[model samples]
Target: MNKYIVKMLSVNDNNAFFQLINTNRERLEDFFAGTVLRTKTIADTINYCEEIEQKINKKSYFPYLILEKESNVIVGFIDVKNIDWNIPKAELGAFIDSKHEGKGIITTTMASLIDDIVNEHHFKKLLCRISSRNTRSIRVALNSGFELEGTIRCDYKTTKGEIVDLNYYGKIF
Candidate 1:
């Protein structure tokens, strides 16, 4: 396993948060399609950080930054968004730094997060939605014990200018 750690986001981590967004903008755009991030400047990251702070404070959404143990630099992220505490489920998404791709960072972070959420928070399941065309992402999902349930067509618009489908994967605890 990699020498990395995952922790919850804090309001005071402003600089670190911004750096993660700035540093991974291109990688994010590549993994996440239909991003209007090209038009948004760094100020956009500032605003997003503010918004995320409020959400974390309220417990409605949970986000984490992945840090390399040696450098303490954020090299990836794992987000469990739109959580319904009563429902015991969350929408999961993650991406490692492009330079660090294929290093099992996302997999380790995800497995660790799921263990925490299920054991500490009593979560019953974690679900992920991956664009069908993204074989790499789908591989991560499957590698982390997520089972393919189904697909939603036209779920997202790709960078290549086509509406693509998404596959739903789930892991039950």
Candidate 2:
């Protein structure tokens, strides 16, 4: 198994985070539209990290970074946002650096993180809304124990300005 260190996204990670997105820009553009658009430079990343830190403090958004254990490089990100505390559920989003694709990093990290999200946050369910065309992400979701629920029509807009359908998958705790 690939070793990793997962932790909350901290403001201190701005540089590494920016580099991760910079290197994976093309591959992340579609699924991570907002992130790809917001983190165009180190300055932008610093600002974004500050905002995310505030949200984390408010318990409104949870963003976690996955680092390669040996090198301490930021290789993947997982977000639990759109949290509805009444139902205690949140939306799940994730992306891995292109170079780390096919390495099972996301599947393993996400599975372990899901357990923590449930135990620490009291989240009842987690949903992943994946672009319909993104087979890689769908595979990761399924491998991480999510079930396909349904297709959401025109669920997301890409940074390139195209509206796309999404496949909704869910995992109940």
Candidate 3:
């Protein structure tokens, strides 16, 4: 098994977070859309980190950095955002650096986090909205116990301005 750890994103993680996103920019653009495209400069990253810190304090979003245990390297990110307190649910998003892809690290990490989010965080449901073209992410969601709810046609506009369908998967606790 791969050794992995997941922790809440912190302001002090700015450098490691910037490096992770910078190195994975090209690959991340394939699915991340507007989010990753905005962080081209270190200043942009610092601003983004500050935004995340604010969200954390407000309890509006929870972003976590996925790290390799042995090397303590930032290999990926998994976040639960768009939190709705009334519904007590959130949307899930994740990406692994291309260099770290195909290692089952995200699967392990998410599986563990799901439990914490549901029990500790008291979220009643969690959902993942994935690009239909992203089969790997769909599989990861399924493997992590999210059931396919449905697909929304032309739901996402890529950074390149192309419209794409999205697969919605969810788990209800």
Q: TM-score for each prediction?
A: 0.86, 0.96, 0.95
Indicate which candidate wins on lDDT.
2
Superposed model 1: Cα runs more than 4 Å off: 30-42, 158-161
Candidate 1 pairs with clashing backbones:
none
The deviation in Å at residue 40 for candidate 2 is 1.3
Superposition error at 7 for model 1 (Å)? 1.2
lDDT of 1: 0.78
Candidate 3 lDDT over residue span 21-40, tens digit each: 88888777867655586577
lDDT (Cα, tens digit) per residue for candidate 1, span 1-89: 56999988765665676666666666577444322352255566556667777988887778788999999988877887868888778
Show where candidate 2 strays beyond 4 Å. none
Question: Higher-TM-score candidate among 1 and 2?
Answer: 2
What are the clashing pairs of model 2?
none
